[model samples]
Target chain A: MKLIKIFSFLLVLILFSNCHREDFLQHNRESVKSITGTWKIINAVRNGTDLTDRFDFSRFKITFSDSSYIVDNSVPFIVTQNGTYHLDDPQYPFKIYFETPDNFTKELDFKYPTTNGVRNIVLTFSPGCSSNSYTYTFQKIN
Target chain B: MRKSLNYIKRKISWQLTIVCAITALVIAACSITIDSIDQSDSINGGETMQSTLHVTISTNAEEDNSRLMVAVLVPKVWNARNNASISFTSSITDGTQKMTAVPVGTAAPQGNGLDWPTLINNKIGHGGNLLPGWEWAAFYSDNAYNVGGNINLSVTVNIKIKTSQDNISFKLGYVVAESVDGLSNSQYYNSAFPGCFRVFGTGDLIDFCNPQLSTVDPLNSLDNDIVTLNFDGGIIDNALANQSNIFLCAKGITTDGDTLNLCRQDSTTQLISQGIKKWSIDIWPRGFFNLPADKQLASIQYYFTDATGNVKVGSTGDGSTPFTYTFKCQ
Candidate 1:
């Protein structure tokens, strides 16, 4: 009887530990859902200078649905493109990989969940040797 | 009773050991199958794989007939699989009628060098038609494949000209004149002002709608005579604008088969406004007229140099058979 009681206690402990591990994995997957929706660019800055007035930030919008995204920018003659995007991690300091139709690929670093529904995306483009960084602030609309 | 208990315990222990061994065997088999599937996916272009194809067509000026050299390049990722081949088909349309270009011959795949025929044909060995000039129908068999990252597969075709027809071309953007002041005026190059104008020797002026034919006599030096080249950023890639240098160079060929550099304008900077980067260059004819009358302006070449030092030369003139344009002086 004593041996059976000890085995029963260990079985319960093992099952509980397994459930805890599964919960952690489930949370990681659910985090990606926060980024799915319509986002509009509210502020844009490059380096230490504000570029919102220089660029038409109001016309720029990005819509994310599942693993695909569409970027619409009217400032540069009503340009529209759809591409595939992926997030390396579902947590903070997310790394994003974007592939466009013209075979242009870019990797951007993102800081998200700033205030619960806002995301701060930072894109660094270095053509040749000079590095130019652009930081865009996006607010979730839908 | 003690003997029976011992027998039962021994039997249960043997059963447990067998069950553990079977479970381990099942897991090992599952792992090997999963690994095999992943390897197969990588060899084939799986859902996660991405690739691009680039095609370029150029005229073979050395050949007497109108021959077009077509080059097809595939990304390195596409060639990772064994026995990978690409089949290509193209058609050229000249207004009302369309004709297919036929392959003259297949030159071997050129590796890294841009040189034609000799080097490429010796390396890969080509299989196609050997006729010169453009063909009514062209086809490249599935023998072309990317050897490596830098190397590309190229094939040459002859374009057959049935009738004198103008090939459809698209003008992504155009150069426009800015107002007399520094401020930009959309109306300066519109129908009202007509962006192009000519100055005659009699001190008379005429505005022409066609900018290419805008002429000026060498003697007219009274007017300011300014022409602006407007570049629409919307039509071009913004990334290219940020890293490219736009300039105009006047090239002339001597009878000795030498190229003469007559004059080159300074690099132009683009103005960013309303999401478009408008690049304009002002040309003062006074400086252009200083060239000796014997030296004719063969062509006005618009050159674009990218960040990687790759230069693309284009001209604003008629497309002739030999691909040579003469800047006629009035």
Candidate 2:
């Protein structure tokens, strides 16, 4: 009887662990779906200074379709850049890794906030130079 | 009865051993499957994957001339492995015929001995280590006068990277120069006389056969010594321009407060190569040797000027100002 009880306990533990792994994977997949879309830069701040008038922020558009992304900038000149991006986690504090066409790999954190029934994406870039930081607030257009 | 009981115990032990073996095998198979699944997930993980090879071309304006220079730059992580090498083959096409490009060496302060013309024939990093962010350059000379007049020059380069694990090839094209004027106007001191001073033994005539100075300073020169000042006109097309208009002048101040004119030559007959002219002057340092002892030679200046007095070439100060070289008299 004692041997039968031990076998039963081990079987239950294995099933519970398998279910937990599946739950974690499903959570990650669902998180990735929420962050995929076309986002337009509505506001930009650099080094505690606003640079909307100095730069044409409205001309910048980042489109995300499935796993790949492309950035189109037409302010001073029309330039299109394509790259691949990945999410480190599907939950809060989302870290997005980008690999540029020029062979540069970088990571940026993204925040998803909903204000007044509108979803917004915010990205900050601190380029390891001085105390300068660039914050880009994007609105989901599509 | 005792023998049967012993046989039954042995059978039970065998069954237990077989069960344990099967369980261990199942556990090992499960671990391998889990690891494979993790690897697959990581690859498909929402991230951008990149190709192994990347190449780019950047241009910089030459300070002395109007010609533009193109440099090939490679990323730091592209070739991070042992026994790795890269081969670059570049050519210039002018819509008619293709010609091989002459690999230009880096400018002064970085030592002229580090030129890449000799290394361009083989793999760049063979038998040596190639660090990240290294650059190699080539320049377009207007040698072909037939394909002249505001023509577009295309520099097509083929790069091959070989490693122990894999080999990759990249073909890159760049428009190095457009509307290039066929007339070349530039000059530099001959590489043989690096710093504009050549020393020789006492009573030794200027050896044209071996122009390269054996030493920067001749410790054996007596009171009266003759030294040759050799200058090569670099890329300057003196054939098209007036030959008599090009001349070089050297001036020195004696230790006795008197100005001494060493040597001046206006002859353009010495042809180093096609379109390249040579000017040489032999100077006897009477004032330099007249110094008591161990006094340094000062205020020795030389310059090349055109008929219009516009400094065409010199060793110092934007090639317009006079170039000076000083050394202690032995």
Candidate 3:
């Protein structure tokens, strides 16, 4: 009887610990790898407009690390912006979202809406933004 | 007994295998059923309209007791009493004359007709609405104050300012004085600059040739702001004052003069091929880098400064002219 009791107790403990282990591991599957290096903008499509010739992003750079990111559009009139970002996968084709210092959040589910990948990628201005949404498509220019 | 032991061992092994299989199934199922976290709504429409950025740029380098004595007279001449106040102590030396130095924090004798002009009198906006490179201060020393006098003069002035929600502003200001003393008998006053630029490369320090000064000052309507002395492709002859140790300097007619200097250099191959220059120093009374480049020349930088001394202001990290630069080679 004592041996039976010990086995039963051990079985219960194992079951309890394993209950949520799988779920937690699954939730963190997309974030185990480092996504803070550089990303190249393959192509962008925005709002039925082809605005690719508007800027040059060949020498651009997108740097993300330590909860901050800098998108330096390496061109004249450098359209550089820096803030915090979030993602579902934190990897290639990562679902990216933008946040500002004042806590304004904007999502870039994919790329742009106007110009296809031919134009430089631009992060568009979102709904309720008083300023015109400018789209910026960029490949990581490391 | 042996038969019973075998039965028990078989049961335990079966139980363990069953548990492991269940665990794998649960893990695979959990991974498939995972929900993506919503990170998009965290920062939407969050910024409130920001109040204007308020700031007053002043130098702490010249705030000794002797300097305060001289500063007291600045308000008298500039008539800035209503906009600000000036005070000094009898213990401080009057840098201009042999008068007994006043104590710290004592108010100076107001000059006849001394009073701060109304903000309207200033063409520049108030509450921090001034342009980025403008500085204004009303100074009153007996006008006889000269350098190297027993009375050393330093300055500190405060002005109200404001900023926009994004912490960016259309205006800025600083406290500075005008003296006719940059190089003997040369009066330094603020003049309008079209803009200013910053240039610095690795070439500044470890040069293959002799040392030379490069500038990035942009003066409005004056070709003098865009000055350059090239030492490349030829032997710099010292007989011609042609040594690469070229020195450049500019003095403003007022406090509006701006200064820029090259701070660093980086070189690389085709992977990262463009040059990246960082702004290293700003000597304007009101510090700013609003000047745009008039021309882009390969192997060179275009910018301006009031005088050559301004370029070297922060060379030793003294922070007097506080700025730095970076250069990228690829």
In the range B187-298, model 2's lDDT, one tens digit per residue, is 1100110111112222222222223211111212222333334454543442213444455555665445555553333342111222335444433343323443344344
lDDT by residue (tens digit), candidate 3, B21-57: 9876443221001011111111111122111111111
In the range B65-145, model 1's lDDT, one tens digit per residue, is 222222221121112122122222323321221122223343322223323233323332222211111111122232221
Worst 10 residues of 3 chain B by lDDT: B30-39
Model 3: residue B84 alpha-carbon error in angstroms: 58
Q: What pairs collide in candidate 2?
A: A86-B46, A86-B47
Runs with alpha carbons beyond 4 Å of true place in candidate 3: A1-34, A40-46, A73-81, A88-107, A110-137, B1-330
Query: What C-alpha lDDT, on a 0 to 100 scale, does residue B42 get in candidate 3?
Result: 13
Query: Worst 10-residue stretch by lDDT in candidate 1 chain B?
Result: B30-39
* Reference-based lDDT, residue A7, model 1: 100
The lDDT leader among the candidates is: 2
Candidate 3 chain A weakest lDDT stretch, 10 residues: A125-134
Best by TM-score: 1
Error of 3 at A20 (Å): 14
List where candidate 2 sits over 4 angstroms from the true fold: A1-33, A75-80, A126-130, B1-330
Off by over 4 Å in 1: A1-30, A75-80, A91-93, A116-129, B1-330
Give the least accurate 10-residue stretch of model 2 chain B, judged by summed lDDT.
Answer: B30-39
**Full ranking by TM-score:** 1, 2, 3
What TM-score would chain B receive for each of the candidates shown?
0.23, 0.25, 0.17
